[model samples]
Target: MNHKVVSLFAGAGGLDLGFQMAGGYDLLWANDNDPDAVSTYKANLGNHAVLGDIREISSEEIPECDVVLGGFPCQGFSLANTGRRADDARNVLYLEMLRVVASKRPKAFVAENVKGLMLMSKGEVLRRIVADFEELGYDVQWKILNAADYGVPQRRERVFIVGTRHDLEVDFEFPTPTHGRKPDSGKLPWVSVGHALGGLPDPDSRHDLTNHTYSKYKLRFNGYMGHRAIDPELPAPTVTGRGDNKGGVVVLHHPSNERRMSVRELALVQSFPLNFEFACNQSAAYRLIGNAVAPSVGRSVAQSLQQALKTAKVAVKGD
Candidate 1:
C-alpha cells in the first residue's frame, strides 16, 4: 500500500479496500453522503474518510493523491428503473468526478458503475461520461468487468472506466480474471458459497435470523439464508442494505446458528479482510457492502493502472 488514493462516493470503502489488498495504495481521503456509509468508511479507514456529499466538498480542500477511485451513483442510468431517462438529473454526477479530477489532477482514476450503464439512454449517457473525461484532457479506456471473474463468487458485473491525462502517454488494460477462468484444483475448482461460510452456525439455530422476515415469505423460503452464512462455491448473492427489513435474495445462515450473517462475514464475501471494522449498525453495514467494489476486482484494476503508470513514467524519462 505505497500509492496514495482519494475515494469519492466511497460506500463502505469497498473500492479502497480492494486497492489495499492489491498491495500498493494508501487511502488519503474518502467521501460519501450517507451517514451510515460515512460511519462505516471512517471506522474501517480510520480517519481517512471525508464523510460528505461530493458536491459539498471543494477539490482544493482535498489532499493531493496519485489515484482517485469511486463508484458514482447510477440511479439515473440504471435500466432497472424505467424512469431513468436521458434528462434524469442524477446522470450528471459524472461531472462531479470530472470536477474532482480536473481540480486534483491525480495520476489516474477508476470509476465503476452498473453494467446497465452501457445501454442507458440508448448509450448516450455512457458516451457523455466518456466525452466529459476527454474534455477534461484525459485519455479514457472503459470495459464491463464481472466480480466473479476476479475471484469473488458473486456474479456482479460493472463498467470500469480508467482515465489518465492525455499527455501521460499511458494506456491501461483491465486485469485478467484469476478464479473462474481457471480451476483452482483439478476437482474442487474455485471457492464456493459453501466454502465461504463453511463452518458458520446455522440460521435455524437462532431467532435473530428470522426477525426481519415477513411471516409468509419466511415460511415459504424457510431454508433460504437471510444475513446468514452462504454457499461460498457460488459467487455471493448481491449484498443489499434492505436485509434487515425485507427479503431481497437468499442469504444463507451458518450451519450451526440460525442468525443471519454478521457484518464481518458480509465483509469477507465482499473480499474485505477479517479485521476491517465497519462503522454503523447492521443496516448501515448492508448499504456499505452493497455499494462497495469487491476488493479482488479492485486489485485487478489496480494492477492494470500500476502498469500503465509505470509505462507512462518510462516514456517521460526516455523523452
Candidate 2:
C-alpha cells in the first residue's frame, strides 16, 4: 500500500479495502454520506473517511493522490429499478467523481457502477462519462467485469471505467479474471455460495460471527423475493442495495439449513472477510453489504493498475 488514493462514495469501504488487499495503495481520504457506512469504514479501514455529501466538498480541500476511485451511486441506473434513466439525477454523481480526478490530476482514475450503465440512454451516458475524462486529459477504457470472475462467490456484474493520464504513456488494462465459470485455460472454477458460507454456524446458532445474525423481518409469501434456496455449488446472484422496507429483494436461503442466509453469510458471499465488522442494524447491514463492490473484484483491478503504472515508469526510465 504505497500509492496515495482518494475514494469517493466509498460505501462501507469495500472498494478501498480491495485496493489495500491488492497492495500498493495508501487510502488517504474517503467520503460517504451514510452514517452507518462511514462508521463501518472508520472502524475497519481507519480514520480516513469523512462523512459528508461529495457535492459539498471542495476539490482543493482534497489532497493530491496517485489515483482517484469511486463506485458512484448506481440506484438510478441499476436494472433492479425500472425507472433508471440517463437523466436520473443520481446519474450525474459521476461528475462528482470526475471533479475529484480533475482536481487531483492523479496518474489514474477508476469509476465503477452497475452493469446497466453500459446500456444507459442507449450508450449515450457511457459515451459522455468516458468523454468527460477525456476532456480532463485522460485516455479512458471501460469494461463489464463479473465478480464471479474475480474469485467472489456472487455473480455481480459491474462496469469499471479506468482513465490514465495521457502523459503516463500507458494504457490502463483491465485485469483478466483469475477464476471463471468453466475452470479451463488455467483458470479456477467459480467459487460457490457453499465455499463462502459453508461451515458457518446456523443462523439460529447465535454464532458470535460479526454481523452474522438473522434479520427480524420474516420471509413474506409474496413474489417480491427473488432467488431463494441458493444452489451450494453455484455463485450466488447479485446482492441488491435495497432494504427490507421495500420488501427486500435478496432472500438467500441456507444451503443446508431452513433459514435464509444471515447478514454475515451475505457479506461472505460478497467476498468480505468475516472479521470485517459492518456496523448498523440488521437491515442497514444488509443494505451496506448489498451496495458494496466486492473487494476481490476491486483487488483484481487495483493489481492491474499497479502493473500498468510500473510498466509506464519502466518505459519512462528506458527513454
Candidate 3:
C-alpha cells in the first residue's frame, strides 16, 4: 500500500526524498517559505511543494495523508547558537506543525529537531511537548539518533519524536544502528569522510560536478565550530548553518585541511544523492545542506514507520 505523506518546513526535500526512497510513500503535498528550497524541491523531487509560511497556509490547504513529517526550524534549540534564548520565537514553529497534525489527524506524525532540544529548559520543554502530543490521543515516543550509526558520513545527532494514533494499536520502533564505532556481528564500521568523498574531483579542478564550489574563508584552528582540522579517517563533525562575520557560510575544512568542502561535498557528507541539486547560490546552498536531515538517517526512520504501519494494518484485519 502506498502511504500518502505531507511535509512541512521541507528544506530542499531531504526528508521527503528519504521517504520516497523507502518505497510505499507518495509525497502528496509539501510546504516551505524559502524560494530556493521550494525551487530545489520542484526541480529534483516534484512540483507538489507549495512555497509559503506554514502559519499563513491553513491546514485546509493541505491534503489528507497517512503521515505528517516535519524537521521544524531548530536554530533556537541548537547548542551551536551561543545567543540562543529560552523564549526564542523560532522554537515555537513546531506548534505550527502540531496545529496541522491536530487538524488532519494523520495515522502517525514525525518531528525532528536538534539534539540540544532534549536539554532545553532543563528538559521541561521536551516533557511538555511530549505531553501535548499525548493529549492529542496518540502514543508519543522520542529518541536521539546519530546519523553516523545509520551510514551517513557525519556524526550528526538529532531528536526524533514519533506519535501514532492510539487506535492504531501499534508501537513505533526506532530503527537499529547498521554502522557503528566498532563493527559488530551484523553492523559495519561508520563511514569515513575519505570513503564518502573518494571519487570527487578537487574543487579547483572540477569535472562537471554540480554545485562543486567551496568557501574561500581562511581556516582557523581555534577549537570552535568549523575551525578545526577534519580527520579523514573518521566521520566528519556536525555541519552547521552558522557563518563568518563577512557573511560567508562556515563550512568544514576539507579532509586534506587545505580548503572548505564544496556545497556538493557537504551534501554528500549529509547523505544527499550525487545528482540532488541545490537551486540556490553557494552560501544559501550551505545553509540548506547544513539544516537538512541526512537522507540516509531519514530513510531508516521512514522504514521503521512503514513497518509499524504495516503491522497495524495486519492487526486490524486479524480483528
Model 3: CA > 4 A from native: 244-249, 313-319
lDDT of 2 by residue, 1-319 (tens): 3778999999998999999999888999999999999999998999989999999999988987888999999999888878887789999998899888877788888888998888888999999999999999898999999999988998889999998888778757899888988887989999998877767877676567877776545544344544455678999878788645532456566665356677888889888998999888777788888889999989999999999887554222112
Candidate 1 off by > 4 Å: 181-188, 202-233, 241-262, 314-319
| lDDT (10s digit) by residue, model 3, range 1-319 | 6888999999998899899999989999999999989988898889999999999997889998889999999999998887877799998898898898898888889899999898888998789889888888889999999999999999999999999988888768999999999989999999999889988998899389899998898888887788888999999999887775332546998899888899999999999999999888888888888889889988999999999987674333212
Q: Pick the winner on lDDT between candidates 1 and 2.
A: 2
Top lDDT prediction, candidate number: 3
Candidate 1 all-Cα RMSD: 4.9
lDDT of 1: 0.70
**lDDT (0-100) at residue 14 of candidate 2?**
90
Residue 216 shift from truth in candidate 3, angstroms: 0.8
Find the candidate with the highest TM-score and give its number.
3
Ten-residue region with minimum lDDT total, candidate 3: 310-319
The regions of model 2 sitting more than 4 angstroms off are: 220-227, 313-319
How high is the CA lDDT of each candidate model? 0.70, 0.84, 0.89
Tens-digit lDDT track of model 1 for 1-319: 2667888888877888778767777788888888877776776666777767788888888888778887898766664556777777777777898888888777888999887789986788889889988988788889988777666756677899999878878878788667663655532344565566665444345543311221122322344434444454466666543334433333434323334555556666777766676656555555566667888888889887888787674332212
Could you tell me every candidate's TM-score relative to the true structure?
Answer: 0.82, 0.93, 0.96
In model 2, the clashing pairs are 1-24, 1-25
Q: State which candidate, 1 or 2, has the greater TM-score.
A: 2
